[model samples]
Target: MPRASRLAVISAATLLVAGLTACSTPAPSAQAEADGDWTPITIEHALGTTTIETKPERVATVNWANHEVPLALGVVPVGMAAANFGDDDSDGLLPWVKEKLDELDAETPVLFDETDGIDFEAVADTQPDVILAAYSGLTQEDYDTLSEIAPVVAYKETAWGTPWREMIELNSEAIGLADEGDALIAELEDEIAATAAKYPSIAGKTAMFLTHVDTADLSEVSFYTTHDTRTMFFEDLGLEFPASIAEASDSTDKFSLTQSAEQADAFGDVDIIVTYGGDDLVAALTADPLLSQMPAVASGSIVNLPGTSPLGTAANPTPLSISWVLDDYASLISQAADKAE
Candidate 1:
């Protein structure tokens, strides 16, 4: 079953040559031996602070893409949330993650696959020393429950609201690899800079990252806000969010804002309408009287994203997803910007 929160749209190819060139080798691990003594570290988060007495050898990750951080940092998690939305038939692991595991010659980590919510039993079965969920939407109850088994490191402020960079930093710190985390972030940033340079057309364009839902009468129309990772991904690419989206947004934590069809004209100023769906979604929106009026749509500046594509995986940027989608993402944005021009 597709998780509702797993909503996004985009595509990607294999890691770009530029990204590979920027990060020539895997980042070094920050285990207790490498970092000298494992000094106790205290981390403040939305739930409260969690203190780690020493470097954790058995790390377990919950929530979207949290496992990637430890994997990218050369640490294999003992357990992790299954890739509910994008996993192939191979035991709930994404291709990139599976590839990394193969390269490390590490045993396939235990996967927790509870669709309704967190699988506490499966997590506890791993007997992890620490549980990393710095980018998760786990509530206080969930945190308290997980804390019973191991120290739980949750998000900093809002649920599912930590930025990609912060997520990497927090996860790195949890595993006692703060310096390697910083280096990894710098490398990813360099890749983003190189991608921007390669596709000058995407810079400075105003974009709206939205999810279109066509109800019985074309009443449901909405877009994601700056709080959403998909929109943040556009900002990473140098695309500006239009003020119109802010005016329409009502809640900071809500992934998207659903508005009345009468207010569709509010989207008129956006240069690009980036959405997730099939090609027919474009046709559906273009046929709607209210939606067709938007400047981007009328001008053919709409970019339809496939739900399970690499670009979609990148809609919620992770340490690994960014590199996987950067080059193809740049090309998609450039194509839309050209139509807008």
Candidate 2:
């Protein structure tokens, strides 16, 4: 949930445009590829099922980080939602995404800005053959509207609930690259496992993911639950979520749980604390009378991640992002774990 609001806006705009463009364009071509006999494939999701009758040439992506899946599989989308964060001077693309596009010599695709809901005209102009939002929090209405323009593949169960591996596999299958998707998953898994092996100190440690709010009374403190991608990232590194956190969590589906300043003592048992904010966040937490009691903060075993930094992007844990931040992220966790030891 590190960048949830940004993601929410992007996804909401995608759904809005899909509705507006439904009646504006002619249906996509029905012709199966003439070069190869592309078999039809059906993908089931939370909203409904979408069957691709042929290999789609123009792919469009909506929602957070779903575009990376297609890019990682060597397919550049015809259009994609613009990233509002972590893009730093590269138009609407993250650095890694731009690098991949350069490697493929592919022109930068059309980027839909979601500052004021869906830009129906822009999305329609791209003329995408298929729209992928398999990691989004789209509603049933959103799916219905999008399906009118082109086949839409939505998240499998809960919106934004698909694991990173499933997101890649589903998107690849949507683009007729299921085998390539499996290979990509295996390769990334190997990379993650290899990175974890380098950080032997991370194993058997109890870690917590939290975010600091710049508030007058420190009222915005939040702790991530097992449902969050950041926690999953730690699990990949062989760290366990502290039992104290599980007992404190209130929502089953949400990624994080909020706590008042008085509850800071709840984090005392956590060996390592991963958080996002500015440099002063550690100081702020330690200054809080209640939070200072926590051992991790007392000993300064806290990792403060910048909101737009590469490690911050890894906190959201997409297929490409995990690779981008693995080495640095692992080293940071190892250093924090060492403090606990």
Candidate 3:
């Protein structure tokens, strides 16, 4: 089934013309036919400003989940980063991605293996008109190199910190489908709200995401901060952030932080602990001299996601993966929250 990969490590628009009526709304599109020339789409991000001069017919996305935007927008990318985590059957395609491709009846595109890093060579081979990495962790050097191949759309603020809605908006705009992106975002927001409402027990409960726990060693605990999209998704699901985590995240821009397990009591405010692991990992956590004392652990309020399955990736929240695993994820969290009660 699922592969053994840690999730903590993983990392379009059309414009319609407005009618003459005052009540008519214009659909989002990057290039409104202006004087027989297309207007360039300019996006500023942490790396640099990316200006897409034309609608990209051959899209190439590097880094995690960037391709999903183009694919969800009905534009198949020429190439994209291969799935390095939660890839069941070792097919390089996550289940949702594969399902989307199958629904479109399109063949799989070239998958750039990002096991080491961005495969510049594989990306360049695609000869793409534009590159999308709106939710990526691309360094300045990586941005510069990728730009040489095509116009690169990168994360606007922090690396791997872009929310799913923004990721869709930026990536879709680069492809001249801004309006469509907005609609897609609305759809997902509604879906999330409806699904979360079904799990009332999780509402207002504080949660923390532990990143890739090492069962053999409980000396330290590493967790995602508010800056990471995974933590941000808690707000989307009606979950609150533990005040301790918020305070710890205040001084750094990093997506993750680690502290000695001896300080586990600091996280007593956390009502639920969500992390990638199995029963043994849970056993290990509960058995730990320090960690076992944390309220979540002592109360059995931890949600252990399987690291090897597509469902494990659901905590991070992606466009396609939401519908695929939202109910299960929410149910688990709600159950854990109930335990806290």
> What lDDT tens digits, residue by residue, belong to model 1 across residues 182-275?
9999999999999988888889999998776663467768788888877888888999888898666544568788778798887777999888
Q: Whose TM-score is higher: candidate 1's or candidate 3's?
A: 3
State each model's C-alpha RMSD to the native: 10.5, 5.9, 9.3
lDDT of 2 by residue, 72-92 (tens): 988899888887777767488
Best by TM-score: 3
Regions more than 4 Å wrong, model 3? 1-37
For model 1, the run of ten residues with the poorest summed lDDT: 6-15
- For candidate 1, the per-residue lDDT at 257 reads 80
Higher-scoring candidate on lDDT, 1 or 3: 3
Superposed by TM-score, candidate 2 places the C-alpha of residue 195 at a distance from the truth, in angstroms, of: 0.9
TM-score of each: 0.87, 0.87, 0.88
Give the distance in Å from residue 90's predicted Cα in candidate 3 to where it truly belongs.
Answer: 0.8
Q: Looking at candidate 3, what is the lDDT of residue 275?
A: 94
- Model 3 pairs whose backbones collide: 2-308, 12-172, 12-177, 13-176, 13-177, 13-178, 14-29, 14-176, 14-177, 15-29
Worst 10 residues of 3 by lDDT: 10-19
Top candidate by lDDT: 3
The Cα local distance difference test for each model comes to: 0.81, 0.79, 0.86
